[model samples]
Target: MRIAVVGLGAVGARAARQLASTEGVDEVLLRDIDDGRRSEVAASLGAIATPEPQSVTAPPEADAVVLALPAGDHAAAALPLVERGVPVVSTSDSVGDVEALLDLGPLAEAVGTTLVLGAAFSPGLSCLLARHAADLLDDVTEVHVARAGTGGPACAHQHHRALGGSAIDWRNGGWQRRAAGSGRELCWFPDPVGAADCYRAGLPDALLLVNALGPVERVTARLAATRRDRLTARLPMLRRPHPEGVLGAVRAEVRGRVDGRYETVVYGAFDRPGVAAGAVAAVAAVAAVRGDLGVPAGAHGLGASTRARELLGQLAVRGVKSAAFTG
Candidate 1:
């Protein structure tokens, strides 16, 4: 199988590398505006990777394409591909960009192209965890997600902006907008990255969970931040963000009925955000190629369809395991 990865940044480069080594993947087409970066990534992947260095508007033909561009570029890169009936996997974490891509469901369906949205760490794996937890229950009512760590520089900047921006949450059968950095809640993730004070953020997970899970009541997403992080959120970043953090984690708390009784389920996974997101996007692209996911020809969140288990299983093989909270 041939897979195309555009925007060879931190996450995109990792996705391309994984795709190049994946079984049944004969070649990975690498595209980036930067010629040097593209060539470097292609070389790192050896003969299986081909650096296109072409504009995103004219991506090479491949069975599936992974779009790992910046926050605002997902829609533009996905549009032409979807119109051509090409399966797409996006790792965008931006709320607006994700919603814009979700709006392309009709167009993708018309062209018989399956577009997997938010195939990254938080929205991607977080959504998967939500699905897994909800499946253990008879029905689901509430889903609360918390995430810590950043992937690339862009991701860190987005996190900064998210804290300062207004957050959209689903509650009481309607969309509600609230202050982003308000409503503090203590959330505990897996080991090494334990408890943190999480606050609502402009994340795409809430919207995705509501759409993907066929939700009933409330859905909210939050990010872990420090006092300084929250204070500087409204201002421009003073310095470049770290290329990747030491570790990143996502937690999903699902509440609903189990055996007609009230039950709460929590599941989480931890890794470097960039690495995990890359793996998620790569696995999703491979699944799209292998038809293992059985996703429909339309835009969808990673866990929106019935392939959550399959996708999660594939991710586990790559060392991105999900842990359940026993306490």
Candidate 2:
């Protein structure tokens, strides 16, 4: 199958490279508005590169398009391809506008194509963890989620400046926002990465879990930086917004109370922001090409459904792994 990767930024570049190396992909097309970046990746991967999504999708030979663009641009990027009968797998986390995303589902179906959104690391793996936890329990009473990461230089720079330091939580059927520093500090032990500090942050998957598992009385998400300097720099930016470097860890913890017992599962990795994003994009792209993805079209978060496990398991075989931690 032929695959096209949209958005040649950090994550997009990584994803494009990974997809190019995957099995069963006859060709990989890298597209981005940035000419230099596109050319560089194209040369490195020995794949086709273009500046327009239309160019990649126009022929219909490209069976799937993986979107690694900014969260807000997902709908804009996806709608056009879905309308043209191109299946898509995306890493965008724009669940706040469900109605807008759902509006595109039919268009994809009309074209006999599939659209899978929210296929990123956190929502994708995090949601899978929650589902696994739910399956092990007789009843789920409360759920809490926390995540933190140092993104690429741009993302890291933004965090250091305290820009976008807001975290979202879902509980009792509503979404709540909190400052990055508002949650309590908890030390989580993730295998391979070791123990790290995490706090509550706003996460889209928490909301999806609440919808699937029932009303959660308390759900919190958090942020943490591997480098002290980065964390210190981000402290001030909590009061402001800025985008900068990206380098750090992506950590998430989910706690569920079942049958009067509390169980916690943690998922984390120390990786380049672009690398993780690229891995997610690759998985989504492969799933789409193989026609094995279980997600429906529309703008859905990774945790919106239980179908993500199949995708996550595929990713794990490629080097991504999650584990449970105690005290």
Candidate 3:
């Protein structure tokens, strides 16, 4: 099967590479506005990758499409594809983008299309981790998510905006809006990533968990940042972000009652944020093509997908493994 990967940025390029090597995927189409970046990534992926220099105004011929586009472009780019019944996997982490993508649930269902939303590190793997933890419980009451590191320059910029923007959380059966970069807490990720100071950010995990995992007592999301990072978040970026960020990690903590006792389960994944996000997008794209997602038709987060466990396993096989906290 052929899969198209739009926007050959760090995440998009990595997704294309993984798709090129994935079994059953015969071809990987790369689309980006940047001719050099597109051709370079396509060439790096070898013969299986074909560069499409033109912009992606319409859905290209492919069994599945992995959209690693910029934050604000995800919804618009996915509209035509969903309308045409093309399975889409979006690596969108932005609050606005994710919400817009979720709003297309009806359209996707009407067209019999599968649109996997928020196929990124935090919202993507983080959502899956949340589901995994919730599965072990009798009933889940709360979920708290945190992450460290950016995926790419775009991701870094998004982090900046998120820290400075309004943050939202689900509390006591209601949505609570608070200032970004507040609610600071010490979150421990997997080995090496260790402990980092995380704070509330404009993350979409709570929104997705509420919609996907049914009602919960509370849901919150946070991002790791330094004092300078929070302070300068409202201003323009001071330095150029690396094309691909340093090692990143995501953590999901689920709290609930099991057998009349309250318990907490934590799951975490460590890797370059871009790599993890790309792997997730690629795996989701392949699953869409193979009908492994098990969603009849519509937009769904990894947390809500019927094949959450299977996909999580697939991700582990791809080296984006998650481990439960023993402590």
Candidate topping lDDT: 3
Report the C-alpha lDDT of model 2 over 45-74, residue by residue, as the tens digit.
874443344344443347888876655567
Off by more than 4 A, model 3: none
The better candidate by TM-score, 2 or 3, is 3
Off by over 4 Å in 2: 47-61, 93-113, 157-166, 189-203, 212-217, 225-248, 255-262, 304-309
| Models ranked on lDDT | 3, 1, 2
**What is the Å distance of residue 9 in model 1 from its true position?**
1.2
Candidate lDDT values, in order = 0.88, 0.59, 0.90
The lowest-lDDT stretch of 10 consecutive residues in candidate 3 is 51-60
Worst lDDT run of 10 residues, candidate 1, spans 51-60
Clash counts for all predictions: 0, 30, 0
User: What tens-digit string does per-residue lDDT give for candidate 3 at 1-327?
Assistant: 999998888899889988988999999988999888988997788899888758545577899999999889999999988988999999978999988998999999998889998888988999999998898888999999999999989898999999999999999989999999999999999989999999999998887888677669999999999999999999999999998999999999999999999999999999999999999999999998888886678888888876778989988888999988998
Candidate 1 runs further than 4 Å off: 55-57
Model 1: lDDT of residue 80:
83
- TM-score per candidate, chains pooled: 0.97, 0.76, 0.98
**Over all chains combined, what TM-score does candidate 1 have?**
0.97
